[model samples]
Target: MKKLLVIYWTFFKMGAVCFGGGYAMLPILERELVKKRGWTTKENLIDYYAIGQCTPGVIAVNTSTFVGNEIGGIFGGIMGTLGFITPSIIIITLIAALLSNFAHIDMVQRAFGGIRICVCALMFMAVAKLWKSAVKDMLGTVIFIMVAGCSVFLDISPVIYVILAATVGIIADKIKSTSKE
Candidate 1:
């Protein structure tokens, strides 16, 4: 019960201040779950992040659910999800009411422009950190480099990239399996 409360509060704080969407919450989630609370290890968190990315819905909420489920089960998943989303729901509702006025303000627009840049930076930092932890060995490095190139230059869909990577992973494993025999 006490542990569940902690999970709820940690994710609630994350969801509250998280801007720039799901990826932006990675650093905060890591800090809360790994550094502050010691609830999960770095490797486990990275795995959860990767899984969260591939799953439906927002990455932050998915991650919170995974973490919660890991710690406390179904009830934990519910609390964690609620904790992760409550802020966005409330903020968006409030913003919807004030959006017209806010949009008309020149200062607000300028501030939003700056915030967008900072948000991108934060997301990039999270991606870099996660990449460093997730990618291991030459094969993994090659996949990273190729996918990154394709993502940037080829203008291919992300779904295609994920499929390609998975195909390559399967082929590589098959080769490894045959070699050992």
Candidate 2:
């Protein structure tokens, strides 16, 4: 129970301050859970983030549930999810109440415009970080470029890029197998 409460409080604080959506939460999660608390390792956090991305619901919520469960069990998962979402609930409610009036305010509008830019920057940073981590060699670089090209030039879905990458991987493996045999 006490452990669950700690999990709840920690994620609640994270949720309250995390801006620019799910990817933006990663650095904070690393700092809080991995660095400060030593609750998890960097590798564990990265693996959980990857898994969280593939799961249903929001990534942040999924990650909170995963980490919380890993730390405190089912009850911890419940607390973590609730904690992470609590900030969104409160903020959205407040925004919903004030949006109509605030929308007309020039300063608020400007602030939001700046925030949108910042969110884009954050997303770009996440992409760069992931690229550095995932792209290991020339083959990996080629795959990255090909995927980017397909997405940008052909307007291909990311799922198609993933499929193509898997196909390439299989073909490469078969070529190596044939050479060995």
Candidate 3:
């Protein structure tokens, strides 16, 4: 019970402050889950993030669920997900109720503009960290370049890139293994 409550509170705090979606939340996730708590390694968190991206629903919520499930089974997953979303629900409700009254205010608009800038910075930091961690080998670098280029220039689905990368990774691994034998 105590563990569950702690999990809930931790994620609740994250949800409250994690602006700009999943990528922006990565630094907080790393600090709380990986560096501070030692609940999981960076590699595992990245893996969970990747999997979360591929799965249904928001990546932050899915990653929270995966980490909670890793920590405390099904109930943990439930608690984590609830904790992560509860803030959004409350905030959105309040904003919906109040934003119309303030929508025309210059200050409010400026505040939102500032917040957007901050979110962009946070997302860029997250991407830099992910790139440093994930793109190690030459193969990974090649894949990263190709994927980045394609994502920027092409209109293809992200899922297709993920699947193609996974396939390439598997084939490369098999070839490496065969060459050693």
Q: Clashes per prediction?
A: 0, 0, 0
For each candidate in the order shown, give its overall lDDT on alpha carbons: 0.85, 0.87, 0.91
Off by over 4 Å in 2: 101-181
Better of 1 and 3 by TM-score: 3
Rate residue 180 of model 1 by lDDT. Answer: 100
Q: Which lDDT tens digits does candidate 2 get at residues 1-181? A: 7888899999999999898666767899999999998888889889989998777668888888888888888998899999988998999999899998789899999999999999999889888887777888888999988777777778667777777888998998899899999
Off by over 4 Å in 1: 1-60, 63-80
TM-score of each: 0.59, 0.59, 0.60
What tens-digit string does per-residue lDDT give for candidate 1 at 1-181? 8977877887889888888665667788788889988888888988999898888787887888999988889989888989888888899889888977678799989998999999999889888888877798999998999888778888788988888888999999999999999
The lDDT-based order of candidates, best leading, equals 3, 2, 1
> 2 or 3, which is superior by TM-score?
3
What would the C-alpha RMSD of candidate 1 be, to one decimal place?
A: 5.4
Ten residues in sequence with the least summed lDDT for candidate 3: 125-134
lDDT, residue 115, model 1: 94
User: Candidate 3 on 1-181: residue-level lDDT in tens?
Assistant: 9999988998899999999775778999999989988888999999999999778788998999999999989999999989999999999999898999997899999999999999999889888877876889999999999999999999999999988999999999999999999
The lowest-lDDT stretch of 10 consecutive residues in candidate 1 is: 20-29
Which sections of candidate 3 miss by over 4 Å?
1-73
lDDT accuracy of residue 79 in candidate 1:
88
- Pick by lDDT: which candidate is best? 3
